[model samples]
Target chain A: MQDIYEDILRLAAGKIRQRIRAGDYASHTAGLGKGKLQANIAVMPERYALDFMRFCQRNPKPCPLVGVSDSGNPNMFTLGQDVDIRTDVPSYFLYEHGTFSREIHDITTLWQSDFVAFALGCSFTFEHALMRAGFSLWHIENDKTVPMFRSNIETVAAGPFSGPMVVSMRAINKSRIQEVIAISRKFPLAHGAPVHWGDPSEIGIKNIDTPDWGDASPVTDDQVPVFWACGVTPQVAIEQARLPICITHKPGYMLITDVDDDAEIPVIAHSNS
Target chain B: MQDIYEDILRLAAGKIRQRIRAGDYASHTAGLGKGKLQANIAVMPERYALDFMRFCQRNPKPCPLVGVSDSGNPNMFTLGQDVDIRTDVPSYFLYEHGTFSREIHDITTLWQSDFVAFALGCSFTFEHALMRAGFSLWHIENDKTVPMFRSNIETVAAGPFSGPMVVSMRAINKSRIQEVIAISRKFPLAHGAPVHWGDPSEIGIKNIDTPDWGDASPVTDDQVPVFWACGVTPQVAIEQARLPICITHKPGYMLITDVDDDAEIPVIAHSNS
Candidate 1:
């Protein structure tokens, strides 16, 4: 049964990639690529690569770097054998001088010799872990995007990269908060544990209903709003930096990788050797 | 008696700072300013501040940044109201193009308008915590420096900064390992928890008895050699980066701060507001 499940996952990923490559699927990837690691993609010129890498390093919770492609390389060999950055994602957003330029299906025409692509870990992996642990996520069940807010937290500044941390919220029962923390803490790549819980006002969120991004889910009286560092944080930083040109995956349209969702994403500290 | 203890701490820090400022005390800071936080200081030109900040952010376990001074500011008001980066530390080491230049008592004359000072958390705070928790550290008991080695562990590289992680070792009884972890994990600024334990060979330490830096501590049959991320890791990276001029506190001559030794060093993730 396990072998059959693995086969099904491979076929799903392959078929999804094909559809995305052929410009047939161009939408958010929230529920697709189940049991696989999905990544938020950021593409920029080689000149900003070093600083951007530093930015991601300093802000690992929001921008957990999964794989970084070498200059001009669209193939993320580390992420997968045949992963192509330009077309594997369902949608892409282009930003010029920190301003939104346009949304496109593919960036093959814009790919440059000096371009570098960064694949950051998304919250989907931990969300899967939470589900496996018998915790229900309202956003997924209700078919709504996870609500994200710009928090008052300031990220450690890197060169031309500094902004308020963005967080995604999920309403979890107060009793199961400890269980959620224990499960999510294991996936450091997926933003680790909740950064804030209980009080939205503490993190500068004035209204829980009105999210800066994504649709809000109902927060019951028994539930406390739990927040995790959002992958959109790097996007906020990039916009604040106002680089000449930057590209990112459109919201929810992530690049699904060959990595298993349950695989332990190695923390940076232990990988020094 | 409690008020008197606090008074003594204030007097002790002031006297030590005065002696160091006047060049009366020019040596390692070990065993000095007990119960107060001591910081490892790094000073560099503002040009490299952003990159260096990113480097510290990326490799946080090794370079747990406690405080960062504004550009051209020698006064680290965040660490201490009267803290002056130029002369408060007992001794200073100057490096040029990654080469050691000279050990000096003061850097007032060499201070540049573009210079930014960064104060990193040191292991001393955790060591004190360990000792208070009734764990006997062999190096401290024997009045020897803590054993530090270059590990196979690679720090997340940022800009021109990248090197093998340096770790400080303490021999702790196998039975007390959990207690040590619980105590040390509380001090994130002080390189929290052991990165590796038991086998030195696992982290590529060729000779446990001969550390790359500091004196070797004896590992008894019942005790395991527990390693924690060392502040020296940043010095190694700075050497590799080969910046024009980088300044750091001399070994053991840390800058004692006003922060309480046992106070919680807040994690960056929850501090958005």
Candidate 2:
């Protein structure tokens, strides 16, 4: 299983990033890296950074900001050593006037001097933790993308960023729903816990058989569909704002960072250590 | 005990803020309010708000942002209903050109047209949780202020905000230290768990009895001196920035908010409920 590749995965983060950088790898980064922090990327001009940050702060579940690049700086130094926002992520989706443009492999030519890159926590980190604990996930098992839906939960707006919260759903066996919730709770940066369970209509999803994004996997009689705040929620808001220009990671293709998602902030100073 | 005043305290949030606003309560807000979130206040011109926010984002443990006002707006709408930043805080400390200017009861007259208010989570919330769980904090038991010291732990800087982190010391019993850690870890907003334990020298504190701020509560032989990131850290950074004008809460006087300290984001939407 995945454990057999554990050592490979550990050694893969930087190498895979290099491969992606060289145009050797340009697909979904679902299982890439050292099984550490992989982020959902959003790049925008400096002028909108503050309001966007406020929106993320207010609606943390949908947009848990894990790291941010300083204005006009492409390197996310705080996130990881030598992690460049311009080329690290495998794919990028361009947005102009809040509308999706063509997806591209690299954006070195379009880089703006004042652009700020924001890295929000992705569910992949928690999913990794959950699988490590011996739980099976539907998407990983079937080799399909996880189904995501636009929910009715209204996000608290800040300036021009506002929209319905997007959620990713997983159908878990009824017997393991509680354990799943408990496991996910430990990773707050990774969406924390399910916003709702038991009913899809509870959050205004008209049909569980269909998802707005990704392939659908209907809940069996013995499983409960659990939902988590999706990183795509921010993309939805950012898209709606119709900013003159913005760039986001093509969903499922993320920036792999050197920092471990499981690592909490250092309690002891490195100087003291 | 605080329990004796629980009922009265349950109804005291708005009334206390009203008194503080009307110039009736000019004392510390350590034990006031409905026992929810209490925040450290920082007010500065809008030009500095983005950078200050970056500072908070980069250094979350010591500067965990709980709420922020709209640019130039005094009302902290997201934190609490009718919580005005201008006069709700009991005491205000002014800083001009990186120097302490004066301490005043209110800043109603000094409120700037483009000022932004930031509310960082205070340690009081977690302290409240620990005390409610039957743990005795040395400072609470002795009616002295918690001893705080500037430590060797340097904060990740953003723009002009940079300094050594300030830590509050509590002499927790060696036996209960683990329990204290568990309890405090639940309050990430409230500085979370101890940054250091055992020896103060490990964090470059040569004198435990001589705190840089507040009263001294030296560790006993059977107890361990536990240190947590202090909210005063941001104040220190803001002061060192040499801003022409800025306002902060006096050492122990905090802004009480209606949001519960332990309240996680709603697992289900209110509209769904």
Candidate 3:
């Protein structure tokens, strides 16, 4: 199992996709395929494509849209070869008119020609880069989901897609704040740098212990909470718009891609050797 | 004489209209307002509005559209009070079917009900900031127009707005590269930072001294020629489209606005700051 874990970390897209397709492995894919890009998935009716695309354009921080697919074909050729959206992710959320309806492992039966899929860059890639660069992460150390909150910040309205931006919070020591910002900026497709830091109420988070989604984590006395725009913002926008139907990956389940993570240009010129 | 600069800048928006209405102020608007925003102007027929808008969206570095007025109406309420597009700009270049027809100081005679005016952010504001930040500008020091070149890099095209990008080059000492980037990024509406640095040939500039437009400056061995996307790119596209009639500011000539130069937020820090 240890040998398999090491090999999976370096596996190519085809092998990983095959494992995911066959249901041979079903755990969290956070560190799997170490350097490939991963994204949050939002599937919706084609009728809302224009409005949703505009929403992504207007609020690039929270919903940094990477690849938008043509109405209903599952193959995202731009993201990777033979990438099937219907069965790519480990899990999904089915929403109906702004409410949580249910969760499904596969949406192959629900696939439609009128559906559109938007792949948004996730923070996991940047988080990985930061850790490799020696920046410590509290949520990762404690094995908890990063704290998330609804902020007072308003997203630019696009047709019916309008709502407050949701952000993920991580506590970073003062000494490493610049290091974290430098590493994360490279992945603009990922949420990028912290939109807000220090005080939580400034962005409308009432309490640090309670989060709208995900497991809560504690903040140490010496650390300040750094907030990054989250991928979940688009999902929140879909819910707020009360679209008749929409589907998204369950909070932590993401669509892993073939794009090499190392392919990204680090915004920082790493300190000389 | 210096005391008159402010009064001249504060003329009743209506009175300014009268002089522009009468074909006065035919020179470039460089130092007219002293501390007000001056914008690059683009006038196009309504038929090409949406595509041109999308082109601006795709290529924001060169075309940071500040204000886009409604089709046919020359009055731009957002830009200034009683600001008439036909007469506000100091000079206009009329391009007919991809050819230069004539240069005119005012365009009331050529005004069409379907014409739309787009106000783009110019590099002048950022240049001012750079000077205040203590960076020396070679072209401005020499009292010459900044060097501009047609690069091999192609802009993302939309509809008829397809052409190679034009860039303005500045020679900066190697030690100040980061400082220049940090200062310029604050003004995104202005062309922002260099698209390419260090190697001019990498972006397809064949001769360092021979520019496609404007006078070239000498670059010392300790300096690198940094390039920023120029507003002239859209003009090239408009000329290529060969519409029956198109009007633009004659190179250096620009429209001075009543907006304060320092009024904008340098950095948007949420309450957390």
Fnat of every candidate, listed in order: 0.03, 0.13, 0.00
TM-score of each: 0.73, 0.92, 0.67
Model 2: docking quality category? acceptable
lDDT of 1 by residue, B1-273 (tens): 444334434457767787779876676676667777899999998778766765675566788777776668787665665788999998899999999999998999999998988889899888888887888888888878888999998887666889999999999899988889878876767887778898999999988999988897889899999999999999999999999999999988899887677643322322211
lDDT of 2 by residue, A120-192 (tens): 9899989998889887888889999899999988988888999999999998899998999888887777888
lDDT of 3 by residue, A11-61 (tens): 776677667666655556777766778888998897776567656755667
DockQ of each: 0.13, 0.36, 0.11
Instruction: Give the poorly placed runs of model 3, Cα more than 4 Å off.
Output: A1-6, A12-29, A32-37, A41-54, A65-119, A129-135, A174-195, A244-250, A255-273, B1-135, B156-162, B173-202, B207-210, B219-224, B234-273
RMSD of candidate 3 to true structure, Å: 7.2
Model 1 ranges with Cα > 4 A deviation: A1-41, A45-90, A104-121, A125-129, A150-165, A177-207, A255-273, B1-39, B45-90, B113-121, B125-129, B151-164, B175-195, B199-207, B255-273
Which of the predicted structures, 2 or 3, would earn the higher TM-score when compared with the native? 2
When sorted by TM-score, best at the front, the candidate numbers are 2, 1, 3
Docking class of 1: incorrect
Question: Could you tell me which 10 consecutive residues in candidate 3 chain A have the lowest summed lDDT?
Answer: A264-273
- With a 3 Å backbone cut-off (N, CA, C), the pairs that clash in candidate 1 are A152-B272, A152-B273, A153-B272, A153-B273, A272-B153, A272-B154, A273-B152, A273-B153, A273-B154, B29-B252
